[model samples]
Target: MADHVLDRPPEGAAADWTIAQDWSAYSAADHETWDILFARQQQQLPGRAAKAFLRGLEVLRLSKPGIPDFAELNDRLHAATGWQVVAVPGLVPDEVFFDHLAHRRFVAGNFIRRRDQLDYLQEPDVFHDVFGHVPMLADPVFADYMQAYGEGGLRSLGFGALDKLARLYWYTVEFGLVREEGGIRLFGSGIVSSHGESRFALDDPSPHRVAFDLERVMRTRYRIDDYQQVYFVIDSFEDLLRQTIETDFAPLYGRLAALPDLGPADLLPGDVLITRGTQTYASERAGG
Candidate 1:
């Protein structure tokens, strides 16, 4: 379970929570884990991830050696984008997460993954949080999209539409792509963070990359335990904001309520299909 947003800090607390970010507690092995992951991802991201994401890496000075000090990173981030990263134990509650995002404060899990779990980790660690997410936050359009999503999240909570809204976040923030002059480039944190997924997402023929449709996305399902079966593609971050911000979601939610949910790889009549995936990879997984 994620941490709840409304939970109050203890009385007269020196900081917000008791989980003092014992920086020294990080052993040499832990630092090694960060270094290895950082080096690998940095090498892989070029030509794969969006330009803005790469620029963010330079701006944050994250390309330097060893694990980054959160305090130092925040100082630079706050100055650049009015966004700051806060350390949390792991996934926090929906409201808590939304509240932080609404205020341009991203709550990242402070821990880094152990070397053994490099390929996959069930929970989001510093690699997933900072490496995957932070870079894009530097872009003004993407930054606005995130803050708007946060406000929408809080609104969705009032309407009991968190599940639907979460699907949007998962697809857009976690695994979405954007069309560029050269070709489609990665923007979603999930795709940017994974070495294999980065290649698979662009090079493979097993998943459909369709133009982003808000109504379709809200009714679509996503996979958590494996690679994404379908990915939504956007023209630009500006397109994302223009489409989403101009429309009120109340009616859209009502419209989606009457429709059936789409499976991970399933394409519909409404989709602006880029590729009709063969689904060979997904099918093999199903068989196995």
Candidate 2:
């Protein structure tokens, strides 16, 4: 969902990258778009998405309709987990982004995509930011993981390993899966937010659903323009938090830097295969 990363601050701003949501500035059309996208995804996510993600929706009252006001949403979120959603012009610099997360502030873009762009948009907007990501912040474990990631991001800056660390975010925060009590379920915001990807990630069988491996994931490249060829699965939120927070990434980064990068579709012999993907979907798309 985070396709843009602003490297510099906007002109004539008091701060580096923060902006006002100006919630009232949104026209009727914007609110309607939220309603449409929200309703559409809700229908698709019921069976396919992680149960925690669904519960987050209700916990935050995301179902109340229209683009959420940051102030209002913050009231509930801050109460529940000390996490609050804030407004951003778009993507902020890496440090700014990490700082916000480190402080439990989630930045959301102020705009919404047009009706025609409903299916896809390269850059993240409010719906993509808030609707896609914020719900999971309702979960105590996920909230802690996000904060840990932010703190980790700051530390990672020193290791000269943001690229490797970013893949961890991509495979987990944006496009991860979980094995629930019944079956595998979608947890990544990127999947939960997309009507097409939600179904594609789970039921397609064309993409590999590999179990979470920190080193393998960091060494792997991911696709931004098409459906992910692989999705990493976690045992639970605790496992993910423990893996990232407890482990010192410095040595891991040094070792990974020397290793060759794995393509989005590549599966290592040692990979814990959840679904051995055929890559049919990616092939067909590439052909056309």
Candidate 3:
């Protein structure tokens, strides 16, 4: 899962949700944890992750055997997408988060997960932020989508529609999939970040892999506490970008305000179902 923005910025900081990375302060264990997690995911992502993501790993030098030095990493990242990574203590507030995105800056959590908690952590840590999220920023199309999402996020707030916009983020940025030439592959950072979910999201028969639709995605709820019960599939990154950027969200948001919502497990007649998932995961979780 991704970390939300923390409510308070540090005392006297110029920007919200940003703090110095203190890159030199990390211990040997911290870097070791990053390496282990990085190696595990590196081994795991090849066939499952988006090719753009893999290329990003190399371009960013994420497999360098330690938590990345942000200054060093930024040199390459900025060259690629005009995006730079910044450090945050944990989650930051929404407005601050959108503001960063609008400006093309990514906020990352500075700490690494514990050895025992390597498989899972309650909040996103360094590996999750850098390994999971940063690579995609290397891709121009995905980079544009993120910045647009950030701009849309700020606009959505005025409409009292952050929840709707957040669902779009959940389905697209956090848990999205795309149909590649041979088959569907993972693009969403949430799935790419987790070993179990990376496989489960593709191989498991329990979730719908439906074609992405703007309104259906916005009104739909998502599962953050478990493997996603549904994943939206896009034809290409351009398809995702064009849809969001071209749409007049003001009217679309107004239209969607009155519509009934869907659950993580629910599918509608209008949904373009790619997998028509068996949803055994949800049933098993509920002990049905």
Candidate 4:
């Protein structure tokens, strides 16, 4: 099956614009795909993923086989963090997506990926959107951060700073790491969802993991097609919220405009370095 894209609602469509989720449209193979990804990630995430994410699995009862019903999940989610999942045809417009988040509704794509595309899927499907993301939303601190990000996203759109703001989401929401008593653990949805990236991110000694700094992160660029060359680690979700909430990014963007971007693997004198990656994997890939 091809990837799904969000379409504009038809005239006189419901005010909220949610499509009736075609639950039965899902084939056994699709359910199997969800099952495969779920089981694999569950087995791989024990020590690597943050404790909150794991607890969310049990709280949300995500261990059950097959795709989860948004209605059922919403009951638990709404009660826990006042966040509910809403099904969209696929990726919504930036404004729409932000509006949903700002209101504490996470817009998720209802479809699952085909089995052949297991290792890497280009677009986020139900498994990626729900399994990878929703669990983290159950955590209060993380939940607040997402809502704030949504409001910030809307502000950024108006200021033509969406790209800069997006880097914040990518670094923190998607691929961030956090310092735990056990050492660095995965919190970012992008890393927690993948079997290979999860292992590569933590166990492999290839990427630079530095403390989270808003300005530095906004100035940095990330690779979309491969593993990150650098990962920013946070002390706690509270630390993440406090830093971003207290910051007024308009001035920060001005400073960033005057500076050069850091290469994915480049190290800086100011960075509080966790590990200076050897860059072996990235070098080998470039040669190949």
Candidate 5:
């Protein structure tokens, strides 16, 4: 998840880079902030978020109140999918991240965003990490895919293909869309967590929507600073899991090493195009 790796854990963090969530430390204002963000997403996500994600929100009872205490949240998440959320100071080293995921542990930052920064945050906060991602982990299929991805990540490190592998996580986990009920829906954390992106991802005509292709996703470059110019859509979580677990990535990594990286919006003749965007948004942003 992090863009770069750190040499070691920071102060107060365990060797695994985990810190106590200390739920009691949050102030009343903090709870209010969490409520604000939670309420907004709940209002915006209806008919927009993936069905699995919405189901997760209901099953976890994330609506109960303020910031979720890891102790309580884990009780529900673990029972549902054997996944637990662990607290990290911020982004951990890549290995530390993958290790946590491989073991079905998700690391989330302990802090929530300031009220004024609600619309955007460069680093993920609890709201973004938990409200955005943890719900999806509650799904059995997506949970399996996450763990498989983590195990794959370890092997990727040995091949020095982490960059390529990271693209898979970025495109699928962070900014992915899924085909459902005859349309594309938001399944990616990056879109589901943002008020603006939740709308733009499905309603806007400025971005390309392509069918998910494993090798294609691995070779594509993604932008971290703005709305995604392209999104990869999967048929279903079952298919996504089957594709991840059945594929032999060793050779794929070798092939990817020799290929040139593609820009986020690049279109190929072989691609299964859903939306051939005008790139109007990106062009306007760049022009401005």
Candidate 6:
């Protein structure tokens, strides 16, 4: 989620961009905002969200009234998987982010979105960072995938493929879907965290649901301004971790450099189509 670079830490942040959660500073209104956002997503996600995420929510006991105290949240998180959540000013520099993940520390923003912005916000607020992302961190296999992604990100910098590598994170960590026993389930933080998208990603006919291909994903383009037109589905967390841990991306980077990138909605000849989207939703959005 740390997608941007900061010239330096803001006035109060540490060198690594870490800041105290300052949990006590949150107003009752802020707590109400978290509760409102939480209630809606909880209502939306059951059967729609990945089972691992649900299990993580139960394990972490994030059901309490207010925004979680990081100290308490970390105790449950660290106990489940060797991971802890730290507060950050906002998006940290990419390298700083990789370093944090490489060591199993997840950086989250300390603020919540205002009440009016419950549906959307330009910057990821605390709810999106913690409620949207942390639950999955409790899963052992997914936790390893995140660490592997960080280690891979550090390596990608030397190759000047951060943008391409970023597409991997955008597609998987932020907007990915996974095939479970019953059907495809939402695993991506972007989808699960969003009440609108949690349903649209699964029920709407406008977006393509395709199987995950590492290189194809790296070469694809994604939209940040709206709901995704496509989502890449993984076989399982174990398969994803296996692929990421075992692949050597240096050679893959070289090959990808010469290929054309795919648009968010482009359906290719080789794509494994799970749901061939009509793209009616995106088309209507553009028309309006």
Q: How many backbone clashes does candidate 6 have?
A: 0
Q: Which stretches of candidate 2 lie over 4 Å from their true place?
A: 1-7
- On lDDT, who's better, 3 or 5? 5
State the TM-score for model 5: 0.98
* Clash pairs, model 6 backbone: none
* Model 6 C-alpha lDDT per residue in residues 7-56, reported as the tens digit of each score: 89999988889999999999999999999999989888988899999998
What lDDT does model 1 reach?
0.84
What do the candidate models score in CA lDDT, each in turn?
0.84, 0.89, 0.88, 0.86, 0.93, 0.92
Comparing 1 and 5 on lDDT, the stronger one: 5
Clashing pairs in 3: 4-91, 4-92, 5-91, 5-92, 5-93, 6-91, 6-92
Higher-ranked by TM-score: 1 or 3:
3
- Alpha-carbon RMSD, candidate 5: 1.0
After superposing candidate 1 on the true structure, give the runs of residues whose Cα lies further than 4 Å from its correct spot: 1-20
Tens-digit per-residue lDDT, 148-190, candidate 2 = 9999999999998998999999999999998898699998988
Ranking by lDDT: 5, 6, 2, 3, 4, 1
* Winner of 4 and 5 under TM-score: 5
Clash tally for model 2: 0
Per-prediction TM-score, please? 0.93, 0.96, 0.96, 0.94, 0.98, 0.98
Candidate 1 lDDT over residue span 170-258, tens digit each? 88999999988769999899899898899988889998888898888988899998998999998899989888789898888777778
Q: Whose lDDT is higher: candidate 3's or candidate 4's?
A: 3
> Clash pairs of candidate 1?
3-93, 5-96
Candidate 5 pairs with clashing backbones: none
